[model samples]
Target: MDQSFLLMLSNLLHLHNHLDPTSALLSDAHSPTSTSSSSTSSSLLTSSSDAQWRSSYGLSYPVFTTVVDKLKPYIAQSNLSLPSDYAVAMVLSRLTHGLSSKTLASRYSLEPYLISKITNMVTRLLATKLYPEFIKIPVSRRRLHETTQAFEELTSLPNMCGAIDSSPVKLHRLPSDYNPSTYRSRYGYPAVQLQVVADHKKIFWDVCVKGPGGIDDAAHLRDSLLYNRLTSGDVVWDKVINVRGHHVRPFIVGDWCYPLLSFLLTPFTWDRTGSPAQNEFDAALMKGRTVVEEAIGLLKGRWKILQDLNVGLNHAPQTIVACCVLHNLCQIAREPEPELWKEPEESGPPPRVVESEKSLYYIGDNLRHALADDLYQRLSR
Candidate 1:
């Protein structure tokens, strides 16, 4: 087994290693390889006096039930009698437990491919329904500024609309008939790329779902509608241009993984000499961008499906997209405190970056400052 997989197993089994302590449910309940086929499938107790052992640790049952209820319309429209509710529950359980399909098949007395298919089906339902509802743009500039101001206080950023980044979700390699480029990864692992823009609220604003594993965050943006909206109009600075055409594009926030564009904001580097005020402003901007990192971290933390490689299915691309949508749903349902986004007033300035990484400083500082100044002028105007 690879070190990463071993580490994951260790982390999962080593309950005390985590900050939030819990009893080893999986260990007590069943072995990872145990066949669920032989077990009695009676109605399990709905209520557990043990507050700690709620369905999937309390949220799973409600989340699955809500999802199933929403999916009923689709099931009715499609006239399919397939057990979508069970399928949804199975998928969530798979995600929560990080069990292999073979392991799951044995436990549920279902075929391995069927487990894969059901998981994919549920994800598609999620992509169609849940994704659009959870991810949305801020409708007004006032709302945008207020959102930015909130992040600014937290991360010392200004005129920032949101945080943006790309994360890799590993997938099992399909047969040779599938496009070979799709499964390639920088680390030589099979994976897929997802680009997301998260607002100051840490809510996903816009999402792009079809880059190959090897594509970096920058490459994904180049192909996204978000990037197209940023490069359309007359040059503001030598590098900045307006790209918003017929569609109204909100100001997007990303890290240094993107090129200089009018609508996006990033951070600053050390070597780039700027006015102290400008540096302060860039510092704030980078701080706000950190929320995307946090959002991605939270997403991966909840869905171990993203942590390891997924292979064997024919519909890998669709599954990858569906995972992102489901991730957003999980975020919304979990509804972490808004106070999580609030910048602490007492926090001091961020630590400086090392000199060796100064080569890319311009990318962060220039785009960040230009966008900040533009938004300030726009909002002030």
Candidate 2:
């Protein structure tokens, strides 16, 4: 037997003599009342106060309890007897609080490796399993109509599906063999670009995490499955709006870094003296796109793990996706958001304009102009 295993065995025996033998081996099926799992939901898991629990896990007790109820079955494994709440708490502590595995082990009497292992498992599980259930872009006309109306109310643009943007999640540089330069962001650090499409509610319907930080926003979005679906006509924005005799499909608004598509709108350029209609169009479009910035801000604000990314490079991106899942969950649960989350200043320059087929680009530009004209007319009225 390994020395550590023998030591664990000896400790188990001695520990069980004083404590209940069965309690030491936490079972997945154990109820909250079970002695082994009793401490799983305790605020003292890492802190003494409920405030600590909320700040550390990014969810209140009621919310956390509901989440753990569902996680019980999914986290079950034959060899591992780790309680479900313990698994969730461990993962959330790392994610929401950004506590390191070593520190968690020291505080919780767990093996540091075990802490890391559980965090990764739960993160990947949330990203893979829970993502589809919670993160969905409404394809239904009713929901789309409602969302578009909401955006129009806010900014006077019709058939606006969502706002798209990319934010940098700071990370350590990968090995040169892994193309280190690509991960080096214009922010003067290694990062992964997290692309998100957020609705007015600050809920993300599409999240793409494949791009490295050095790439432009346009390249990042173009490579995403969301972009493919939109361009390839797989994700059909069926509700087309008529404005001043021009028919416009439901579209997403983005910054100048993104190219204008019939399904994606970008602001028009303005010289020192620009037209009133063009300026109003840009203003309304930006107001609509502000949701993405707020969404990313809330995401990073609520989950501090993305602030510096303490996890390994391979797992960092998945961790970010997991955070997105949790963010939507919290938003749905009506969890109280911390006001402390602040968006970092945009240190990178705007992405270069990507060349596309002129036919669609012109059509998109015309639609944009029409929408701007429509909004300008609305302001005039």
Candidate 3:
């Protein structure tokens, strides 16, 4: 047998002998029934009994010692005025356990005020340090090409760009109209929504939060910084269309909700009986768009905090934003494969059906034919 196991057995035996398991004396001393004399006796028994318990199950002093040593830097920089690692551990434990601050204090032997500070400090650090690594614009063409290739390999979709969508994190309904509309439920609950643009690699390039719940995807796009990127003249592509003759090529892709701008790719809609060509085109388009769906699944899977977060009014929206950033961090740290995209019980609508007969608005036959020709030419070569 292990030496440690034998030591634990001995300690258990000592506690069993010193502490009376069946007697009510331990409980009575802390109760109101105890007089001053009995209280003193109870306190002595409790102290000695606790010491024995520690000797049996408690972590070794060197364990805490090593953790504290490694935590000194995080502690020194923290504004909490307490040690950093202690604060971080306290916050993590609370988040993991979902315990009230008072409960955490009693369990962890920490001050309640210090617990709050630790949570806030660690959250802010995670947002600042970890977020940018996985959620930023790809500035270089080489990186963009790498991303494009990855998407093509994963989904067999050509000229692979990115996946885009808006996900609403539900919030508690408030009384005021302003607060009420901020929580929309096209799904099931009121929420503060964040627009996410993630690429094939499951990295979020741009994340915009704080759009109103009552607003549609188009309205959100109108007010987003992402819209500015679309309209920006700096991002140039040579082979794509020229709606306004801008330098920017139409390399980026969005779904139907996006505007028919010069540099974006959307699906082709077929009228009347769905042509084989159109079905193939639509399948290809959905193939690329599905990356975002899979990415979102992986994101929610890893950071379960996103699935059940209910932040206070002051930090509700920001917390959602922070969660998105952390989601990206986890994605970057551990890139899971296609299995991450497994179907949830409650998924969105069935695949779009613009049958051969329906007259859809953007189902421009001439334009689609032209676009299809161009794509075929490039892809064939």
Q: Which candidate is the best by lDDT?
A: 2
| Candidate rank order under lDDT | 2, 1, 3
Pairs of colliding residues, candidate 2: none
What are the TM-scores, per candidate, against the unseen true structure?
A: 0.66, 0.85, 0.62
Which of 1 and 2 is the better model by lDDT?
A: 2
What is candidate 2's CA lDDT for residue 348?
37
Best by the TM-score measure = 2
Tens-place lDDT per residue, model 1, 145-210, is 577567657854344567777766667554667575666665566677777887665667777866
Query: What lDDT does model 2 reach?
Result: 0.75
Better candidate by TM-score, 2 or 3: 2
Distance from true position, residue 48, model 2, in Å? Answer: 9.0
Write candidate 2's Cα lDDT for 1-381 as tens digits.
344533433332332222222233433222334334446344223333345457557877666776677666678752445657766866786787677777656654558777677788888888988889889987988889888999989988888889998888887445567776788886768899999999988899999999888888888887899988877789877887688788888889988778777888887852314589988888888899888888888888888778888877789878999999889988888777666456655533444545664566777889988888888887899
- List the candidate 2 regions with Cα displacement exceeding 4 Å: 1-52, 106-109, 172-177, 270-273, 344-356
Worst 10 residues of 3 by lDDT: 53-62
124-215, model 3: which lDDT tens digit per residue? 65555545654676656777777767766764544456777766655544436456644654665666666777787667887777575555
TM-score of 1: 0.66
Number of clashing pairs, model 2? 0
